[model samples]
Target: MEVRVLPGEHFYGFLRFYGKGITFPKGHVESGETYEQTALREVSEETGYKNLEIVKSLGVVTRPAIETDGTEVIKDIYLFLMKITGDDKGKAEEETEWLTIDDALTRLMPQEVEFLKKIQLEIYED
Candidate 1:
C-alpha cells in the first residue's frame, strides 16, 4: 500500500473501494517484478498518478485475509511512502481522493487508520 502525499498541502492520496471503503493503493507482485515495481504500477493503475517518487518504505504488515470465495490466507502488505512529483494524471481504475490527516483518519478503515497513525510523525518529518 502507498501512503502518497501531495506536496505543499500534504494531503494523503487514498483509493475508495466500493463496499470495502477507503484504503491505500495496492496489488499483487507480478513474476520477475520487484516489490517496489509492483507498488509503483499498482499506484499508477489505481490512482492514475504516474509522477511519483518513493520517499521510503514503511515496512510490511502481515494480516489474515478472507477471499471472495471464503478462502483464508495470510497477506503481506508492503507499505511505501510516495510523493507526487508532478501534476500528471491519467485514467484511474478506482475512485481516488486526497484528504488531510484528520479527514483521512475518519474515512479510512480501522486497520488503515492504525497504519497511518504509526507513521504519522514519520510522514510529517520527511
Candidate 2:
C-alpha cells in the first residue's frame, strides 16, 4: 500500500496484484543524490503528483528478498510521511484508487501494517 497524504487525510495505493500496498515511487539513488531527492523524483514519475512536502522520516527497513531468477538481495527501504497539496490530479499507473486507512490496512503487507500503526500513533501524540 503506497500511502500519500494530503493535509489531514491519507490515501493508499490499490493495485490489483498487490491488493493495497504502501510503495514509494522509488528509483536507484543517483550519484551524490540524497534518498529524499530520489523519493521526490520517483513519486512524480509513478503518480504524476509533484506538489509535496516531507512531514517526517519514518526510518528504514531492510529485508532479504529473492528476485525472479533466484538471486538474493538485501533491500533497504526508507520511508517518510509527506503532505501533498492540491486535489487528486495524478494519473495512476495501475488500476488504483485512494483508500481509507482502515481499508488500506486490511490489504497491506504485515510489516507495512505495523509500521503504519506506529506512524499513526506517533501522529496522534504530536
Candidate 3:
C-alpha cells in the first residue's frame, strides 16, 4: 500500500499517494541524493509541495507487494513531518484526494488503522 504523511494545522493527514494504478511518490534513494533528499523530491513531485522534511525515520516496511506477487521487498520510507507549500487551489494533478488521516488509514485494507496509530503516537519508530 502507498502512504504519504502530510502536514495540517492541528494535526497531520496521511494520504494514499498515487496516479491511477501508480503510487507516484514512492520513496527510493536516488542517485546523488540522501534518503532525505529522495523523500523531499518524491513528495514535491507528487504533491507539488516542496517544503517536505524528514522529521524521523519511520523504519523499513516490507511486504509481498501486489505488483510483484510472492516477492516480499523491503522499502526504506523516511517518514517526515512536512508542511505543504503554496496554495493547492486549481492544482490539476488527478488520482489524489484530501482524506482525513483516519479515513486514509482505513482506505488501505488489513491492519491499516492499527498501523496508522503507530505513526500517530510515533510508537513504531522514533
Name the candidate that leads on TM-score.
1
Off by over 4 Å in 2: 1-9, 13-16, 19-24, 68-70, 87-96, 123-126
- Per-residue lDDT tens digits for candidate 1, residues 5-100, read 445557777888666467777889999999899999999899998898888998776667778899999888898988878889899998888777
lDDT of candidate 3 over 18-108, digit per residue (tens): 4312222455677799776776666666556544545565554333344346665544344555545444433323344555455556555
Error of 1 at 44 (Å): 0.4
Which residue pairs clash within candidate 3?
none
Please, what is the whole-model Cα lDDT of each candidate in the order they appear?
Answer: 0.80, 0.61, 0.48
The alpha-carbon lDDT assigned to residue 51 of candidate 3 equals 46
**What TM-score would every model get versus the actual structure?**
0.84, 0.69, 0.58
Can you write out model 2's per-residue Cα lDDT over 1-126, one digit (the tens) per residue?
234466766565433345434443445688988888877666555666667666667777565667779999978777766556656557756454567668757766666667667776654332
Going through the candidates in the order shown, the clash numbers are 0, 5, 0
Error of 2 at 62 (Å): 2.6
Please give the distance, in angstroms, between residue 17's alpha carbon in candidate 1 and its true position after superposition: 2.1
Query: What TM-score does candidate 3 get on C-alpha atoms?
Result: 0.58
Greater lDDT among 1 and 3 belongs to: 1
Q: How close is candidate 1 to the true structure, as a TM-score?
A: 0.84
